[model samples]
Target: MSTMGRAGQAPMVVVDGVRKAFHGVTVLDGISFEVAAGDVVAFIGSSGSGKTTLLRCIDLLEPIDAGRIVVAGEAMGWHQQPDGRWVRDSERELARKRQHLSMVAQGFHLFSHMTALENVMEGPLTVKRLPLPRARQLAQELLAKVGLADKAHARPSKLSGGQQQRVAIARALAMGPEVMLFDEPTSALDPELAGEVLATMRQLAAEGHTMLVVTHELAFAREVADVVLMFHEGRIVEQGPPQEIFTRPAHEATRRFLARVTGGVPQPTGSS
Candidate 1:
């Protein structure tokens, strides 16, 4: 399967001929797409359709069996050498590359012992080498941005699932990433909590963050995504603007998937 991605003013991510297999089971086969700067690309498909695995591959958490992923003009996990051969990039180099793209997984994954402010501060302090006072200030600002300034002193154990997820987002933003990747970030949350997380993500999209989200929320995808990719059997079967993809899907599998997710009632396309 192949897809020629829509053109953007600046292509922030380029994924080409990517393939991945797990213990002899293929999850992604020749996946290709481009995410432009400040664009939100939503990946939607049924369970086991390889949505999350694709995100993991882009983040370099899963080694691809073939092909390449490039973000912000830097190839992930591999580097082209002087002799024009691709070599596995050093661990240190890969770490540097990851700093450009932050990921939020399904779980909040905050440090249980640390307060929300401290959890957000840890990244800046440990990774970016900011001093305690500076990191504290920065953390507070990020929490405020996520509408969690008042919850700064609250521990993850004390916060609701929604608030903890927001804190996790703040922590990711603390690293000053050029792109953000979300792997079913709200899947573990209840409906109310998911709404809060979606609100946070909506705000991020409005603020011009480049995002690649794997989500089951068709509503959010229709409302916030500039582009939506419909995956099936380890390949993106259809992709286009939200309106075209949702209201006028080109593939039979996509129509069936939307029918299942939206309960035969798809919301009107364009803007939240």
Candidate 2:
């Protein structure tokens, strides 16, 4: 795919003919897509459909076997040399590139010993080398943004699951990423608790943060996503706007998947 978007602007994220496998089993088969800045793209699929793996690959947590990924115009994980050979990017180079993007996985993964504020501040303070005062200020602002101002002093053990995930979102935001990746951010919570985290994510979407979400929350995907990708057996069998993909899916695989996940409840074209 061309690095330049249709309007000649560089796309925020690009995955071109990407393929990934584990041992001898294919996990992602020639996946390709582009995410424009500020767009919310949702990846929907059943378990083991390569959704989470794709997010991990984009974050460079896992390496792709083939194809390329470009984020904010910089190649991720690996780079081609003048000799026409592909080489893994140096650790320092990958680290530098990683600062441009952040991934919020299903697990909160917060520091058990730290307060919410401290957990959010850890990245800016350590990785970005921000001053203590500035880092604290940023963390506080983020906590408040995620509706956790009062929970700032609370440790992970003291906060609810939803609150912890919100803190994780805040921590991801603290890095000032160009793109945010969420791997089923609400999966671990009960519906009521998941609603809280989903609300924060909706707020982020409203604020125009570019996001790539792999979620089972069809409601969120239909309402919030600018584009929906339906993954089947490691490939995107169907992709389109929420209206097309949810209400009138073009592929039989998509229709069946939606039927099973949505429990045959008709999907509305827009948010409830």
TM-score (all chains, Cα) for each model? 0.94, 0.95
User: Over the stretch 121-212, how does candidate 1's per-residue lDDT look in tens digits?
Assistant: 99899988998999999999999999999999998999999999999999999999999999899999999999999999999999999999
lDDT (Cα atoms) of all candidates against the true structure = 0.90, 0.91
Worst 10 residues of 2 by lDDT: 1-10
Candidate 2 per-residue lDDT over residues 1-272, each given as its tens digit? 33224475678999999999999899999999888898899999899999999999999999999999999988999878999997899998898999989999999898999999999999999999999999999999999999999999999999999999999999999999999999999999999999999999999999999999999999899889988888999998888888878878888988888889989887766455
lDDT of 2 at 208: 94
What TM value does model 2 have? Answer: 0.95
* Model 1 misplaced stretches (Cα beyond 4 Å): 1-8, 266-272
Best by TM-score: 2
